[model samples]
Target: MTFIALTKPQMRGLLAKRLRFHIVGVFAVSLGIAAFCKFAVAKPRKKAYADFYRNDDSMKEFEEMKKAGIFQSAK
Candidate 1:
């Protein structure tokens, strides 16, 4: 096994290559976090409410309350 010492230019090139790899890694991690938040942290409020109100009994009760002016805004 032979030990080799890097020259200044070689060291500079190696450092630049490592810097580029680090930048790419940071961007990849950032994109992964963004994608995770986009997919995993989203709450489908409209769809959830639609599903909740799709039940027949609840729909009937809501309509009855509306008919009784329970949801009317005061003038």
Candidate 2:
């Protein structure tokens, strides 16, 4: 039946109207997630890295290793 199948023009028109909205919505959601990750998730990770590097014990170990000649000498 004609009602069961969409005509070519009907399909094309429907796609043309709806596809742009879907694309824009998807783009917006992706941008939001990226921004959230950058501001929310990345901040704590950066803080953790900074704390690890700045800890007294870590620095002491690093200096000890350097003094022990654990690292390769630069030519």
* Cα-based TM-score, every candidate: 0.45, 0.57
TM-score of 1: 0.45
Model 1 local distance difference test score: 0.78
Question: Residue 36 lDDT in model 1?
Answer: 82
Q: Model 1: runs farther than 4 Å from truth? A: 1-9, 43-75
Worst 10 residues of 2 by lDDT: 1-10
> In model 2, which residue pairs have backbone atoms overlapping below 3 Å?
none
In model 1, state the lDDT of residue 47: 61
Give the alpha carbon lDDT tens digit for every residue of 27-58 in model 2.
99999999999999999899988987776586
lDDT of 1 by residue, 1-75 (tens): 998997655644798899999999999999999888777665565567778777659767878888888887621
The prediction achieving the highest lDDT against the true structure is 2
Which pairs, if any, clash in model 1? Answer: none
